[model samples]
Target: MKPSGSLLKIISEDLMPVTEIDIRALAEIYAEENVYLSVYLPVSRENEHVNRVFVNSRVGAIKKVLPADLRPEFEKTFDMAEELLFEPAVSGERGRIIFASAPDSFLHVYRLAVEPEKSLVLDTSPFLLPLARLRADYEDYGMLLVDSREARFVCIRSDIAEEKKHLSTDLMKKHKKGGWSQMRFNHLRKEAIKSFFSEVVENVQGTCDELQTRGLVIAGPGEAKQELMDLLSQDVRQSVLGVIDVAMDISRDELVEESDSVLHENELSTSKKKADELKNAILKGGLAVAGVEDVRNALEQARVNVLLIVKGSSVPGWICERCQNLQANTRPPEQCDRCGGPTSSVNIVEELYELAQRTGAEVEFIEQRDFLDSDDAVGALLRY
Candidate 1:
């Protein structure tokens, strides 16, 4: 993950928010001999006791099933997990995740603002489905709060909102003079307002681009918000999900709360719109492919632009040991079809996720399983 920058301050330097880079790095990690212990638990103050009990029971059960030689190492990782979770610094976090490997003496802890589903997985690689979902749900976005005289730009990422820039420009005040002077003053006041708005728009675009925000939300009291919207370039305007009417003096917490609704609505609408597009493409046999095998092929050829998969979907599959090619299969195969290399068992959905990341394809997790009507529970909108 990228290092924390000056734009925001995290709860702690050690406990940073998960990023796409972190996910990609985790996906690449694998243990050839010793397994990695991945644990997710609700760490909210009220759940402390329950967290301890759950971890103890889960660890004991897994230890019983493990080979005698591996039990000691497994216990070591479990101990590390417990220590990290119970640290006083972890109390306020709504959730916590620990990835530990005893043999490698590796331990990584991440704090979550939102509670994740409680899960423990012992595997060759870290369990990343939860992290993937969290990243998708809380992608970075920009919030612009503006009035005729001032503008504030805030970047919201992983549930943390930080004000990045504040801009203000002076405007000519209303005068009580007679016709000629009054008209001239009105003309100058309008010019000043336009100039201020133009400056605000420039900064809005620059800040959003610098932050690489995924979406934008504009808010203001009256015509200022609409006026700023009108001044934005088409590219920046397209990134704006919606606008809100609010006073300039609104508190940061209130602004975030208001923008939350807009962000949530945008997510739902965007997902539905993409689903419809996928459906149409499939009906016409145009640029979409559904089912695991076809989607895998499209991804392998780098033809996929957007990959759609039902949330929590998985299938028994194989990954070629030599080629790393993913194939979904119910039955085991001795060798890979393409490279004639030995294959290893894997979860097809997870492998598909990694493949999509490797190919720079955007992944959309469909919450409604029946949206695509495919048994494989996966589809792709292709570039070809």
Candidate 2:
């Protein structure tokens, strides 16, 4: 199986490639003790020494706060992280994330093409908000470049565009003799083109299914692109995000650049559409809820169909240790209201994001927009 996005598995003992499955597994892990240590380190050939010093300082500070019995285990996990982060083989990666729990005998390291915010957190579970956001930003898209004679299918994930398949069809040349023979040739050419388009549509369906692409972009010169678009099945047509009029022989770099622009525009459009849906639902008091508390409740009940949040927004809150009840508050009570248990400070936005993922609700991070900025920074569309 191909690794998702530009993520590469670091070559080390117990280090595995980061994929959606890995992220979900990490997110599911929870422990009563705060043994999980998650570290995001940004490294490059030019700043290796600087990153090492930063890691050392962070590790020293973390160790000072740990209990005497857990200090040794924490140090061991940090040592493993340092070895993986500074390895010369992975110097090409822009950053790395390591999740280690020595007490649980678990470790995972991932090399990232994009630089992540440097952070070190010791918690009951892995800090996965950054990874989740990165995964969201790098969702896969399909590109189809077609002309009357040929078609090329490319699967784009992150910044990489890889050609998945190519197809070509032969048609008879136009007859010079303007007579019955020419009409017959014309008829045969039209039939051949129709057959070829049908084949292309079938192949597109197969390729998209195999690659699990989230969206599709059609590009080519002249009318062939539109012809193919008209022939797409209803299911496939809905996935069409954009169309580009470009030369059939466009360079790979240009194709990727153009496709990236289309995908980004589609994302913004989709975000706005969802925001409008949420606003309309709220005005009608249908099945939508806004604000951190109500959205969290919807997520917990698995009634959320889509969860919308403003990018880079956070709400200070607390999660009950015993019942996992989340409450958004500026000042957390000493004990949980639902169950008289101790509470720990948590970022409610991050908690809601993870909860939405776990419950199979689509998460949409809306960029700074007037619609979302005017009211509560978080909202959800319900299933009921």
Candidate 3:
């Protein structure tokens, strides 16, 4: 089975390749008390040099946190993580490693669909917001194609459509009878149409519920598609994105090709709406904040409900291991602001993201820069 999104999963010690259960277990342990180390390494097919480059750069960063006694143990775990790349089935465009040594030493590694900007973070809590964001962006869609005698149901994910069910009425091609027999035949055909539509609705409902389909598309040659749409429940109808006039007999490749532009436009419109919400909130003040420091402060208090980060932005900062305080100070003091304990420097931008996850705030990467000024690259909508 495939892992759902980027949820952390757990794997049995002896398992050669990672499993979906392992990823789920990993998400369950995101709040673990141990020092959580999240490392995102690029392993894309296009970049064969990523492994060697990341290993050299990241090994030094990981060793910086380890005391003399724990270096050997960390090295062993790092080596184990590297071994996963040699397994063809386990390799992916990106790789993630989560490690800790508090209550018990543990390390888990898994593949990622998209390459996250390479990062190595050690924090009080596991970094899960990025994974959540990634999952939210890659959506699942349901499509139903129907005509008078035949219907097909499919689920689309990552632009790939998989046929779930197909139904045919198998109505008589020719009939010879008197006037009374002709009436009866017409009634039977009507009943068959109704039955086919009812079954189609049932199958679509089941698929949507199971897969959490983000949106649904309906297509067919004639009036049956509209008639079928009218039969759907209000909740299901609201999910209907578009009804295209296409022949039900079309190939799956043709179906996807025709639907691609519509789906892409819908996604862009939804993203723009979200960006507008963030922009309006920022203009109104108090309820929202923009830029690095203000949003960081709001996140520290767990006041943020949504974090809007400009795509591909990173800033350096510090996190307090003792008090969990985060700061963007260029020269962090020896002691933490929240508690008098040693603080460590880190990528402040990434730490803010991890904090948003820990606090249950939604995160969105805004690609449209025109929504705000350049200084307002990172912003948040607040609860208070």
Candidate 4:
């Protein structure tokens, strides 16, 4: 059985957000070497047969897109991917295959966790909408499970949770009456508790910083849980969603369940808080922009530090075929505003997300649209 704390941790780092450099490198690839192929297949723990069927179908699609000259390379990569697919999936519900062969003699392949979607694309750049959406939509959080004498720190990123730190204190043991009696014993125990809590705070702070955790969940038995919350620095305290009361040694399944619940709650709450911030920024005419067009403009300029979209909101727009500049309007202009290049219609939401990925901006989907009431369901926090 998997350890309780490990139940929800994503074991693989490949599913984490694709970096800006990776996206830029793909974008920079010459069109003559347009052999980049992206394949997406849906997989699940409950149905191996279904996964096989999906892979076989996508493989057939891949063959149709491959040039005769690339057949050998495609075949080799497919065989390796097929072997891994049949060997039981590592985790996650979707499988993504990114295969590219270029003149630089760079042959690359990646099998990653993805949402249920099927697509086969051949272009100079890999089709990244699915990957970007998966990375943006899913969340990562830090969880601190503690009791009077023990604490566990774990990071849950994109549905995978793993314990990063586990600490137990021998300070819980009974003390002898010889050392200045109960008063001294009590004093020493208090000091030890303080020290332990201090260490936990330090470790959690470091982990949260490293993981770039979006939120935090504090859980465990008794007053220690609350004590830890009180001791957290302001920055850490703001990241917390809420405190959950569970035994320090809670079962992995139980921990996963509770942590997910609290974290989700926190996400909703955080969305509201962020929405308010965006609203204030817009009102103050500070380093913020709202409305689809303004947000798109800010993103095009790489000014967005935080991109906020109302949940389930989308706007149809056009993108420059040559320059990839986004225009949040239905009517395609005769030429792009930035480069006078031809524009083609595309989903503005998707284009915005891909642009944000390239700029290393964080994207958040806000459930409460009220905060964006006059802003057309989109807003951004600008870096400048």
For each candidate in turn, give its C-alpha RMSD to the true structure in angstroms.
4.7, 5.0, 5.7, 7.5
**Worst 10-residue lDDT window, candidate 2:** 1-10
Residue 75 lDDT in candidate 2 = 78
Steric clash pairs (candidate 2): none
Per-residue alpha-carbon lDDT of candidate 1 for residues 93-162, written as tens digits (9 for 90 to 100):
6667778777666677778656778888776567787778777778778999999899999887666677
Write down the TM-score of every candidate: 0.84, 0.83, 0.73, 0.70
Question: Residue 344 lDDT in model 2?
Answer: 72
Give the top-scoring candidate (TM-score).
Answer: 1
Query: Alpha carbon lDDT of residue 97, candidate 4?
Result: 46
What is the C-alpha lDDT profile of model 2 across 235-293, one tens digit per residue? 99999999999999899878888998898898889888888888899889899998887
lDDT of 3 by residue, 17-39 (tens): 12122323443343212256556
In angstroms, give how far residue 216 of model 4 lies from its true place. Answer: 3.3
Structural RMSD, model 3? 5.7
Which candidate order results from sorting by TM-score in descending order? 1, 2, 3, 4
How many clashes does the backbone of model 1 have? 0
Q: How much lDDT does each candidate structure score?
A: 0.77, 0.78, 0.65, 0.67
Q: Count clashing residue pairs per candidate.
A: 0, 0, 8, 7
**Alpha-carbon deviation at 197 in model 3, angstroms:** 1.7
How does candidate 4 score on lDDT? 0.67
Give the clashing residue pairs of candidate 3, or none.
8-23, 8-26, 8-27, 9-22, 9-23, 9-24, 9-26, 10-22
